[model samples]
Target chain A: MFEGGLDLSGAAVRVALPELQRLTNELLRASGLQVDHAAIVTDVFMRATYRGVSHHDIYELPGRLAALAAGKVNPNPNMTIINKYAALENYEGDNGLGELGGMFIMRRAEQLADEHGIGLCAIRNSNHILASTPYVETAAERGYIGYIVTRGAPTMGAPGRKEKVIGTSPMGYAVPTENDCHIMFDACLAYASNGVLAEKAEAGESVPAHWGLDSEGRPTGDPAAIAKGTRQPIGAHKGFGLTILGEIITGILADGQIIDEPQDGTGLVGMPSHTAICIKADGLLGARRFRRRTTELAERMEARASGLQLPGQRSARSRNEMIGAGAIELKEPLLARLNEWSAKLGVQPL
Target chain B: MFEGGLDLSGAAVRVALPELQRLTNELLRASGLQVDHAAIVTDVFMRATYRGVSHHDIYELPGRLAALAAGKVNPNPNMTIINKYAALENYEGDNGLGELGGMFIMRRAEQLADEHGIGLCAIRNSNHILASTPYVETAAERGYIGYIVTRGAPTMGAPGRKEKVIGTSPMGYAVPTENDCHIMFDACLAYASNGVLAEKAEAGESVPAHWGLDSEGRPTGDPAAIAKGTRQPIGAHKGFGLTILGEIITGILADGQIIDEPQDGTGLVGMPSHTAICIKADGLLGARRFRRRTTELAERMEARASGLQLPGQRSARSRNEMIGAGAIELKEPLLARLNEWSAKLGVQPL
Candidate 1:
């Protein structure tokens, strides 16, 4: 459950992108990430905001830093290759910053794809990566089709059971396009994302009956009940099946150790891992032809459903609007917390 | 929609697996597939039955053959590589047999995973590959996580609309496990597969209310009405989003052209190019460690679920029981069709 709605007007703060990046780097450095790792982590967090995925934005920094302080997460952890092949590498993250380690693996996948026309990288012992879209979109921007899957904290309904037994288990796919309208989709297998639940709790709003179940595994609209019970799968058994698949792909296929029991504080922080596959579209088809065909297909889809919008269009539009506004809108309390954290870190307030 | 059950017992026939394979190969050969291609195609079809997925069985073969004869599909079609990288290949199938082309690409993926720890192969201009589970299971058996996606004939409901606008876009994932209990899942994005609708129509049964809508895009339970309309997404918008994602991944990302106009039937006929990625678990951790950990995870899932069985367990058990019975049990009328088709093909009745 969230504390309450934050009043943003009084706590509003603004900083140039570069200035924000510097402060982020500094804070991460203080938390033990190296320069390069800190930069990458900061970029991902900020990019989430730029893309209007504010839930995965800097709001997560305090919790992550607290984890580092509590020794629940490793700082200055090593990420080394455990195995290498023509277009693939298995990385051991040494319980490192998930954002840093995930990006590292995805970057490696991109490099391999550059040479092989396709690349796949899997990492074990990594922490949580805030958002998965950025990794795939990074590959897409490079004219590659990116596919990514990751397992996270369990908060989803299981097959045949109303109880929560799995994480949101997000999956992402991004395809490059000629214009800025890259086709990208990122979603959790759960009917609603955990962030949505948090948002509802903060607003003291009741969720839809289908969002989750009570502690007894009965459907309920109470956000508090969902917090104590299970989040419903996006499409019942289909989504539950997908969550299981995502877990298998990230937990088992990534060669990461799978911990069944909830261990640390909240739950067993499963040794997270991810699989990133990148395909060079242009390599498969001439760039012009690929673009022309994709455009034609896009036009066809639009014609078929005049009202249908591609997955990422709204997010892209929101991003552009936010950029034009020159400042991100944040809840007041969250902004206050950010200011407080900044003050404590001896960094200039945004 | 279906005539009363035909006399299956009087029409029942049994043939050795090898004999069936031989006849299947000959049938394909007669239909213009090369010997090698016929073998692959035959294997795919037989595998469906072996797995107890009779819906995708040889009963569908005659329609396909007729389609081939009508030039709706090509026989002896050439599958050409449009582009290639070390671990990736983009292929154009020239509207060839989906089963043949799909298997070829999956085999390539497996080989690449073995060599490079990962591999991806995407093909366009392919037809249907019955039962996606087999393809992914094949990779899982080889100790890799397999992912498969394909777009089928449009049958799914779109968001905010009761009309059909998307394919039954199915997604499949498989993870290797011990005790032949590999975690595998495959399902169409729709609330029900189109085959389910066909079955309902055949039985003169009404579908569930949520299953679909009538031709006017209004919800209806009449099987005939649903057949003429569109199948609802598994969970409304969520499933709609997934279907869209699948289409983009396999149809667009693969650089296979998409048919925009519903009237053209090109979209329906456009060979589904599959993108398969295999990640070698042993590459991330040592083979022994990977196996042990996966076994532990599998045990935990089995134990945690209590009365619930894993996804593929039922199908596996059914297949074993059917095989042990020395003959597959079939509804009487289907058995008659098999007999009739066998007789026409000059295959001796068992």
Candidate 2:
């Protein structure tokens, strides 16, 4: 789920982080998101682009604005806690953008964990959250292990037949390191993402045989044909069960719309459901020792990997490179699309 | 990971549950485990057999006795809580049987969650805990969500080349239903377990190509060829990442031997590591509302599944059947061996 560098082959421009951040914030606010909520969304947006997951970056700005205009996303959601028992809290997101809801859940989970050693937050009525790395990293930065899983409308098919019964929900985990660093891994339950297969289709390339299947469950290299069929689960029933397992944790606990099917009329994806869990680092040893132990584990794992890549290795490396350069590379088409949306919202183009 | 029925073709006999349990308890006790600890082990052993996973039952009793005789397992472990931070505790397992460690973790986790809404326990110096279904069911029966993950020595390979870097690391979760019922899932990260493949090898059957690979990383149907090579991860790197993630939680947090490799001279698997987490079902709403919602979600998922089997459906079905009949089918060879061990232990044989 965490990969370095969008593989788009197109004209592109480098925009400094602060510059894009400014435009993103303005565009979000102009689209009617409250200023504070817009800033939260911008953090997730900017960090995802800077870390090379550009699919979740400014590329989606125009569609998000349209979603807001069509009332599929609430600009100023009345997020509320529906239930609270000890360290666990459940919330109603009021159909807010998932970026806003995700941040709120992560922060609240950390706060609860700080006091109780472990914490959880479940939210319903959310929309699509982009990449999960940033929200998990939020807790890792505070020396807590963070977990986030969110679901949208169904898009992944299960064992019996070719029909979407659950979303390809993304899940992420972060283990803390010293100096606000983290060892993070994130992934979807599908063997391959539709985006990757669609890109291959556009390039007239045969996709990996294991990535998709015909409606009869036979392996297929034709992305076009497979699109009408099913995306394979990572390892058949194991992956399929995990997808359902994640749904049970988030959608069931949140107890709003299941997101098992799309909503009516709007044809919009089902309102999403989300859950955040955090465990305090100091909850173990007397000091900040969990960080030291985790760093050591990561180091040993790196050596064990030998020629293999560690989880999140590429993403971590690219994140540092982008942060050092202080700029993000954006495809020209994507940049132009964002600029158009910004103009429509009466904001300065990037 | 959760498949129904041992596919082994062999002569077998039905043994009453109480009769088998008495012999199992005696064998364990004679092997040096304390009476209380032996009871815990027998509970897991009996439940696994009744639920159709017999590989982890009396089939392994002789080997477990051998390990204990070799000093690889502690007979009377002083399971110390090395650290307790609010609801989270870290333990030193004292190199005991993982069944003991796992039961302790699950029971303690439930007690902690009872007071704090959530709980966790991490233990080092454990051994194979067998299937996690029993432990997770402990919490689910108490109206909580239970999660358990444990690791042994490296067995599964990773991204770059064919070399074992982590264990298959069985993991499980359970959601509570009404009347002490549960919806549970348990799985290992590998594409297939070694037990299933080895059985196929003995039967002169060609294995599924995805289940194993030749040394050069090409898929192979030859079980012998794959035994020397690498077992494929469930979804390549995704499964690889998950194996290490389990290690980070249990091994790293518990602060003991890493189990990255086997221990010196014993030729035994690395001393295992374990972790358990639970969330109170009523932690969200009053009067066990979480159970109702979870049951609703399971019913919806059953409808969504249509013809596909649910995660633990077969196991649950077999468990109820066996409990109703008060007997478990035991392959004659396995039962004969168990009787031999019981005779040597001076207990009445079946």
Candidate 3:
């Protein structure tokens, strides 16, 4: 967040947590989402926003409600279980918001793991999953190791070309510990996320070199230059390879819709597929012992590596801080847009 | 392999596949490995070498035989299934050559998947498993989607630090396809593999910038500078996070010995752990339909992206070419070392 950040979004806007939640829940309900579906979406959005996962955070609230009202997203998806084979479950999504399907499948996977030591669930025809972190974190909280991967909108350039070749393919993994710092990891295969890039571009800022490539396939630091270009993948080919793997497991294995026609989709809202695998940490060594190992690893890493930031630490710290303050600060423009969307939805503004 | 090569390693030394296998199996047997153990090691080595996985390829054959003779590694290991749940199998290795444990555990995982639709296996106390590719490929060849991950010697630097903080943590994934061209992906979390970098260093070449950082934490193009430096991760923070995730799922989950004592021990041979997961592709839409989906995805990607390289294509192509020629090539120094080690083991020269 602080790569010599350029703050051109004017002043910060503070909104109380409870107020924002009310607005989100009501807005979603008014848009025709069932109560349970609305709650799922609201909880996911809140958690992501508090964790500073800006890409899938509060900004999407308005767009989601708009999508629901316009029938772009299914208001109430059945999420039927199309196939069940022992520890594996395959669900067919009814073009619903991905968070609902993600949560539903992860819960089912946890249940399957409870019965069979491990569970893998794949859900297809789901829309953009804002973030994969929350679903994996859901399992980790239950003292289970969690893994989730989803196909993303195509944005990252392939090995050498500057055109869109594959999805960002966000993947999340988490290890539960005795304590709350659960050693979570979540990131898109791309070098940078579109949310951060868009934020930077709006701020008239330059991005880090190699974050993306210009139209000519040269690494450029200008965020605005990404308009006609593609995001750079991490490790070049290695990251691209990971993206392919993610898609295969989710899109191919789940028999989901993939964005194949457009190599370069700007802010695309294609149906994505998600895969979740969970393992009960109590399988071999009990959860307590496994958690001890993770805690020790964290301590050992902290003691030796001065600048090594352990995963899940930042988000946990951020969530704690936001809870303590009872509020979250958003860019003024973002808050205004959210209020505008709420007004259109006939809901009280945050 | 052709990253603007600096070719100082003399001419290519070709070895007949059958001759290489005989020498490998015989030398391992003479050193103390049982027939099955020797065969496992030999097959894994041959497959890796044929696929041009230089790091875990034929180059390590001599060192492994020496390790067996010197008792650094158990020649014949009893890979005991320490624990088993309905769908999970936990094996404890006896310091055996990791290739032996890898094969045994993957086979067990495959069997478990047959029974439960999915299987997850974790093996602890294993030596360095050369390449994770063969194990995952093993699952793919059996019409199942497979994944394998292994802990590595600490080599990659953590974020904002040039010193060693985490292992390279290589992971491999493969999708079962109708044809031999499965979508396979195998890569360490690091930006560049240590093996490729070491080969470059021996060639007296300047490496790619950001492949590693010098002792002073500055990205250096000189491969020689890496001796006292650390390998850079794929994405600065994202890749480091993944490396941690990999170690946890394998090292921590398996309750194995990790290389925690030394952060910068070059060429350290520590007890690593491995985790394998297998999912029968026939769980949904049947294997034939699943294979068609993968084949279609591969074809679609190829049609659009001019330079985008699909995963598994390279290794499959290399293996095919090597098979067609009935031979594999190695650098002259590697072949000389192999023959020297074979002579010491009282085996015929290569």
Candidate 4:
């Protein structure tokens, strides 16, 4: 048993991945999500943390739970397939939890790709999904290439001008390689994500000048300034183009019209909607041949660019280290908050 | 004619879009591309110029023709569908002219999406395609959302470190909107495209500090130095990630595999293979309702962001002015070269 390097002598022991997933699912179910929905959400949340993305970890769960309890988010959403044709489907998420809705649609895409050479799914009326990588990574693990994008609340920069008109839209892509090394790339089109801004705020430090704007839409580094202003696009116009594309793909392309207001009638909260696509490699080339070629290509790329690292390499290494160390280091305050939430939920203290 | 103030008389006489397309098609056909292939290539070329994308305009025709004469690209390729599923297809382009092959596959995707809700097509063994936006814009014009991505010849910046490892992969997305305004966004992940670098080199101008690196992988503003180094990715690591994702989506995901070696036979020439997708709004929502809602949503977004311009608005405006002016401006040397080429082909001088 790996002790998580925490003071667990008088508290309940930390659980393994599977155990944590189960407990998380139970908690979500108790809060009103269906069993399958809860499981999917739990899987995404746990995997994000397990993969070393602490910013997307369960630290935000209490706030989300509170939102759910207050009916700010739908608990028993009527997510249903609104349209389907051979390798394509469209799902109406009915303002459901985005993690669950996103996973379900991606899985459907995978299944369709398995039967056909390719599959695509677009979903509307969904809430925020913690991380975007897992959806594409899931398809990559199944020997398929995956693409996904989502539009969140308007938190990023506008186009040529400097005001906030779009969200920090996130996009993800994953492809299978040889030896279980799947190359995954995921990112938001903003110069800085809200998480980074939040961290800067907590640290009482200023952000990079290029990260955002000050009041009146001029560039600034003060975190407080960002609250009143907006984040900048990564490469000025280029990142703005990407954000627009993301919104079109997830918002308009998915047949989920890019509305200025939230689907829940709460005004423009910019709740995310998504588009997911899967392409089966085996369908294009025989499975063995595809695998071998992928391995060869990866090897050649690594050999040619001797110093460069492929996408996902760092995350994979971090995950391995966390596992080997049998512990994940967490900020003291965050851990305290987690324990407090656990106590309030009548769950065993971590 | 409007005779707009912008200088464009350096280019050949302006003709109607269709006439220009027809003339281009005739020229390409005379150079050896099949009739259908020539038509599609010409369509893209003409449309690019029509949209004020002079960087990817007909100015490239001479070089493309030279490449064809040198046997660097095939004009009469036996393009074939290598794999097919309900909503997806994999194409073997047989190392053909990329413009033709790319359009063929994207058209196939549009067809499938018309039947299904969405369709995806991946192609391998292709050459350069002038611009990606045309493919997606075509889909948008047909009432479908479109996505296209492709890997280019190696030219990428490293993360944190400054060096070349990948290509300035480009991605494009388009959606149909009301008021004949199709939102289109296309961009390369690099801070500066090679075209811009070449322009700076020609003008003997210093590039922006953030544009690229020096020969020894150090930051520099000298275009010559950057040519010896590599272009920077936008937003550092995040842009690097997007470039990686684009490579996988078009290369490995499409079964072409990432080409790593700088001197590898496969990496020496033009753009690599690509992936294209089309999602039919009518398939996702009923035709009438989908159209109505999309129009409403677009209006709403425009109303909410009252001061912001939508994607492609500036380009469209520029195109209108250029068209009304009856001529397209061109650099003196470029015009001289085009005349030279026209003379060699026994065509009347502009």
lDDT of each: 0.70, 0.77, 0.79, 0.71
The sequence of per-residue lDDT tens digits that candidate 4 reaches over residues B1-350 is 01111233354444455545555676677668888788889888876776775566676766776777678788799988877767767777787887887788889889877766677788877877778777887888887878888876667766645545678778777777665567777778888777777667778899767777887877788988887787888988788877766775577556664755332365554348898888775665665676566566556656656766666777668767866776665555555655665666655545
Q: Which candidate achieves the best DockQ against the true structure?
A: 3
Give the best candidate by TM-score: 2
lDDT of 2 by residue, B4-123 (tens): 233346787988989988888888898888889999999988766766766765577666766786786887899998888888888888888888999999999888898889998888
List the lowest-lDDT window of 10 residues for candidate 4 chain B: B1-10
Give the per-residue lDDT digits (tens) of candidate 3, residues B1-350. 22112233567888899999999898888888898888988898888887875556777776676677778788877878777778887888877888898888788878888888899888987877778788888889997888888886677788657868778888888887768877888888887776677777877888767678888888888776765688888888889888887887787767775547432333344468898888888887687888888887777667667655788888999999999999887777777776887778788978
lDDT of 4 by residue, A111-229 (tens): 88777667878888787777777788788888787888887666665643454567767877877777655777777888777667766776799976777887777778787787667
RMSD in Å for all candidates: 3.8, 3.4, 4.1, 5.0
Q: Write the per-residue lDDT of candidate 1 for residues B222-308, one digit (tens) a residue.
A: 877877877777666657666776776577656674543332345354456677777776676666776676667656665655665
Tell me the TM-score of chain B in each candidate.
0.85, 0.91, 0.89, 0.85
TM-score of 2: 0.93
Give me the overall lDDT of model 3. 0.79
What TM-score does model 3 achieve against the real structure? Answer: 0.92
Off by over 4 Å in 3: A1-13, A53-55, A259-269, A331-343, B1-14, B53-55, B259-269, B330-343
lDDT measured at residue B229 in model 4 versus the true structure, 0 to 100: 81
The residue-level lDDT of candidate 1 at B263 comes to: 20
Tens digits of per-residue lDDT for model 2, A1-350: 21223345678899988889899899889888888899999998876675686676667666777788788789999999998888888899988988999999999999999988999998988877787888988788777889899887677776535666677768888877764447787788787676666666778988756666787767788987677678877777778777877886787777665645445445555678889999887778644676777767666655765666766667788888988999888888777777777778889887
How many clashing residue pairs, candidate 4? 2
